[model samples]
Target: MRPIGIVSILREQTPAPDRSFNFLMAAAGNNTGNLLFTHAVWEHLPGPKERIGFQFDPDKVNATCRAVVFPAANWFGAHVDLADFADRVERLDVPVTMIGLGAQDHDFTGKVDVPEGTLRFVRAVAERSRSISVRGTYTRDILARHGFRDVTVTGCPSLYQPLQPDAERRLLENAKSTLGPTLLHSTRFSARYRAFVDTPSIHLDLYRYAYRTRSDLLFQSELEEISLLVEAAKKPDIDDALIATLLDLYGAASWEELQAYLHNSARVFFDIPAWTQAMTGYGRAYGTRLHATIMALNSGVPALLVHHDSRTREVCEFADLPSLKASRAALDEDAISKSITRADFGKFLKTRGRNQETYRAFLADNGLL
Candidate 1:
């Protein structure tokens, strides 16, 4: 099959790097989703070779690529302009672009009222006659709502992509810190459950750049993100191994000191596990990271997603998981705790497997299965 160029619209993640790319790499037993899909599509290509291009930068994409894959532009924070790029890609005529993440990034770099560059992105994509797919069913719905016809809800590329042997083990095994019942908070960690937006009262330019991205004098919005979670990690119910992670990501006197801090913060018996394993450990989790929730459900963790963005709900409901809406004061911790404990992991797994099969069938029907 011919090698396809993958234009990754990846933006800077919160201070801590999000690992969607990591999962994609795993999909092909390679290092990125671009490679995985390229390899997968290679099988159906009426070509003579068996390799794929590995360009991660959208600007530097090779001209020979007949198609490109983008997880979802909306979730990438919508920080860059793509009108020119889209025009260039459109010139390819036969180029196939995949939009995986849900609608465009809501606010530019986490800030509201800021101009959105992705709206142009959507317009460019809409001009196309054919497309690959997106991650969440909501994406498909939204596209349809927006009058887009050549799109489909293809599960997040991360689920179909392959990964390295022991990658999960390495991600978790390398982690050995002390954590209490701490929520793994990021800027958008639980954005859906609670609108953790920068309060308008906070006037630090870095803290609130008038939109999604924020930074500040003492701590960038990113660092505060780390601080809040680290603070929560001190609970007795938290995992002991994740403490060090907090310390490093946030800042601590030491692992021991971090543990002491968490103890003081409101300790919960939090056994932080791997991204996927956390679902298994918690028996249930409320998360904003789409893949984390997906992994949790796949791991049999009865996860109630805090749909920070559309993808979470789109993916969750697509899998038949009863995801809840995001509201700062909406969730009752007591109620959530009870439901999680009572959730039948086995039943959830069966449901997920059925969804998986149906999704595979969809892919196959599209010649991508």
Candidate 2:
């Protein structure tokens, strides 16, 4: 059977000849939650194994095979440049079906006023596709205003696909009963983007509080520290506090020493199952990394999301994820307890089921599966 083409970042066959360059690219791709989620969706697509693979090259897409599926994420965001991307997607002559697509607002405002480039890309997708699967009501409403009503709210495919109806029930039961002291904290501390924002104080606070409380915090997203450590050695102009915070967080005295510790310890996880499995024994997980928290939730660990941006808040609100705004998330015992205690996984599970059904139906309607 001819494979259903996925419009995603497929692994490059011919990697850069430079080993360090290829290593960084691989890390960047794996560190990105969307890419991981995309791989999961492709892995679980309802079709024969031989009938699905990434077709990012537009010229390769033709009517001889199955329809193209562009899986979900915060694709429509303020920071993204979509003009060339839209043109490339449009070049595909075959049918396109977008699943769990979302728009991101950095300021957390619900209202979305996208630029022409974004509008052009959206219009192109709308024109080519039978229906667009959106992340939540927020995206649905946003796209509706933009004159694209052929949209369905399917939530994130990563949260729903490989669906387990009993997963949430099990997680909730665990939360109420044998919840432990080990906490899996998924952080978003990227030194590559450190200059953009102040590293959301709540994340730092969580690291400190979780460590001091002796709750055994297993931190994810160590690539940023790795990046900083590498950069600090090459250039002396790097921020002193940035270096200090990383050292303090990881308990490393120097960059050279931290690099060795990181390599030896193997702290960063690039694979989804590896990351998800690591969260299993944890009592409760909290993190600003939205997908990491979702992975925890999907894996039946009682989890809470510390939302840092509009994309995070949208998913939390849309899916009823137990969440606190990073701006207001106080690291007090009462506050933490309240956030965890009030998490309604039962409600979220129902929503997840419905969204999964809606998404599958969207694919079926588009002749995808």
lDDT tens digits, residue span 1-369, model 1: 434444442211221234342332223322112332333333333334212333333444444444444444343233445455555554444444554545544321323221234444555655542554666655665556455666656655444423234434332332232222313222322122222333421122112221121111111123222343433222223234444434433335476654344344321111212233432334344434454444444443344455545545566566555455455313344555544444344443455556556546544543332
Candidate 2 — what's its lDDT? Answer: 0.65
Runs in model 1 with CA error above 4 Å?
A: 9-66, 73-81, 104-129, 135-138, 159-186, 189-284, 327-334, 342-351, 354-358, 361-369
Name the top TM-score candidate.
Answer: 2
Per-residue lDDT, model 2, residue 268, is 39
Candidate topping lDDT: 2
lDDT for residue 306 in candidate 2, whole number 0-100: 86
Worst 10 residues of 2 by lDDT: 228-237
Clashes of 1: 50
What would the per-residue lDDT of candidate 2 be over residues 1-369, giving only the tens digit for each residue? Answer: 767776565422222323352354344453546645676667757674232343245775664555677665686766666686577667877777777788887776767667778778778878788878887777888788888898877777777645334666677787665446545364554544543234436666665565455454443445554443232222224467667656666445586775564444333344555666666666776768777778778877777888877777877887888888877776765566567777788888877776677777877788777
The alpha-carbon RMSD values of the candidates against the true structure, listed in the order shown, are 11.7, 4.7
Q: What's the C-alpha lDDT at position 293 in model 1?
A: 46
